[model samples]
Each structure stands twice: as structure tokens, then as C-alpha cells.
Target: MAIMLSGHVIGLLKEYMQDLVEQARQETSAQERFGFAATVYRPDHAISDLLALLDDRIESEGMQVGLPEGFLHEIWSLCNQASVHVADRVYVESNVGSEAGSKARTRELTYRALLAFIEARGRASAQGEQGVMES
Candidate 1:
């Protein structure tokens, strides 16, 4: 049977994440955070690194996501990316005016592409997991 996170669970998850981030925010110091961001990993590397950080944080914090006996990164990617995609399906918050049509449409398209990419990753991860389980 497939388990699902109820709205309450998601809310608590978000709150829990925010609390963790709040602690990090307090600890890092503003200059350190800026210096780190200004000269840190590239976008793709940052994406994977952030995902890994989140995985570690969730595990360390003992937040039970109720996933099956498999990799947490796979589960986290699906959940987080789906939430991002749904939130951006109408308009992306970060989209600025571009040469496409309008800032709004471009932002929507940009996030649509991101959603597709994340979904593709999820599919590939699932296939690989299936293969591993069968082996």
C-alpha cells in the first residue's frame, strides 16, 4: 500500500525545516553566508549538494517521512520537486522579464522545464531502484 503525507504532516515538515534553517541562519553569520554563496558550487552541483544536505538534515533530525526501505534521496527528490512544480505551475516566483514573451510566461515555462527535469529524474531513479530490487 502507498502511504501519503497529509496536509498536516507537510505543514509540520515545512515548519520543522524552517526551524532547522533558522538555526543555521543564526549560526552562519550574514557575511559568511554571503561569502559562501558568492564563491560556492555551480548551479548543478549546488542542486545535488542541497539535496544531500536536506537528506542529512532530515535523517539527523529524526523526521520520519514514512518512506519504504530504500534511498531517502530518491524519496526526498520526488516529494520536494513535486511541491516546487505544483507551486510554480501558474507562475514562477523568480522569473524576470526575458526575451521569450513576458516575464510571467517565461517564468512559467522555466519552472515547467524544471518540473519536467525533476519528473524525468524521478522516473530514472525508480527504474534503477526496481532493477536493484530485482537483482
Candidate 2:
């Protein structure tokens, strides 16, 4: 069975993902400014970053924010399920630029892939609901 997330939960997730993406951008910019070597980044790293964020949020403000119980686990499972799809999307985008900003680009691509997965799931769930209602 698939875990369904409500609009509120999805909204919160988007916010969290944006925060991570922005943090990556800042980190990349700082590294470039400081002449630090760019570290190799990939979709798996982005997924781990998101899962870490979710874990922290669930521990810190899960109840206050009205996150459903098992939310973190559910998201973890979803990430695993979507991993290949996300990685493919990220890989298709040519990584042919300065390595300094590659981390930020990877993060953005990963976030977008995850967002697309969530959106597709939401639509499918909605359509299923509609079908049931019509039945």
C-alpha cells in the first residue's frame, strides 16, 4: 500500500526541500569564494540530506507541525522507491560546468525530481479517489 500525504504535509515538505537546496547553493558559493575544492555530489547524497532533515523535523516538531506518525519512515520508503527515477533524471542533465557549483545544481535537480514524484503520486491518488466516488 502506498502512503498518502495530505496537502499540508506536502507543503511542509516543499518548504523543507527548498531550505536544503538553498543551503547547498550557499555552501557551493562559499566554497567557490574560498577556493575550496568541490566535493563530488550525487542524487544519493541529496536524498540522504532530505531524509536527515525529515528525521530532525520529526524529532523536533513532528507533533507541533501536525506531521502524521511514521511520517519520516514513510518518506524514507518513498525516497527509496523513487531513488532510481531521481538518479536517472539527475544523471541525464549534463554535469559539464564548474565543479564548484555542481553541488547546488545536483541538489536542485534532485529536489525537482522528488517534487515531480510527489506530484505524480498526488495526481494518481486524486484520480483514484475520483474513480471511487464515481463508482
Candidate 3:
């Protein structure tokens, strides 16, 4: 029997157990058959522009912190690209296994990109919160 976890909990667990999860991902399947005791539940055929999501989030925060218009413009210009963003990669990876899919290698790259964004966002948000607390 399998038990499902909420996305928020899984994200938190993934963030916390990243190294352990990476080790699991790297382990060979010869003897015990490499497998996960747990995994993040990703959905299917998702298409979203997280640039918009992030922009909305930033603007919402700005309501309190007051970000500059130019800063928002620059951020938009950076993320508003033709290529797939980290969020898109993560979405695709979630639907497709990390190492098994149509474009497995490409998906892996996308997953990495998404992970990078996750780490960066974590750091940025933490700093933002700290600043709020300090001020």
C-alpha cells in the first residue's frame, strides 16, 4: 500500500533531505535494487510561467516592502525568456522520472535548473525575511 503526502510537505522534505535523496538517486541497483523509500510526487503535463508567479509574489511583497519598478522590469526581462524555465523543467521532471523519459538527459538538466532555482529562492526568501525581522 502506498500513502500520498501533500505537495507542501514533500517540498519541505525534499528541501531537508536533499543530500540523502541524492545519495539514493546515485546508489546502484545490483544487490538490493536501487529504489526510493520516498519520492516527491510530481504531476503531469503542466504548463505554467513561474516568472509570472514570482512577479506576483514579489509585487505582493512589495506592497509592504516597496520594490522599485526598474527592479521588477529587470527581473521580468531576465525570466521572460523563450526557453523553458526551471519551473517548467521541474514540472516536466515530475511527470517524467528523473532518469527515464523521452528526453531524459534534457529533463535531468531541467531538474537541475529547477533545483538551482529552488536553492536560490530559499536563500533569497530567507534573507528577505531576515531583513524584515532586522528592520
Query: If scored against the real structure, what TM-score would every candidate get?
Result: 0.35, 0.87, 0.31
> What local lDDT score does residue 50 receive in model 3, on the 0 to 100 scale?
33
Cα lDDT tens digits for candidate 3, 3-111 = 2223453353234334333433454233236443333323121112233434565566644543444544543443333135655766565556655432223334443
Please give, for residues 29-105, the per-residue lDDT of candidate 2 as tens digits: 89989999888899999999999999998899999998998888888888998999999988876355444337778
- Candidate whose lDDT is highest: 2
Q: Least lDDT summed over 10 consecutive residues: which range in candidate 2? A: 92-101
Predictions in order: lDDT: 0.46, 0.87, 0.43
Question: What's the lDDT for candidate 2?
Answer: 0.87
The lowest-lDDT stretch of 10 consecutive residues in candidate 1 is 38-47
Q: Model 2, stretches more than 4 Å misplaced?
A: 94-101
lDDT by residue (tens digit), candidate 1, 1-135: 223334554454445444544543454466466674323212233234335555675576534654234445454555455555544543443334343333223323433444455556646767887999999
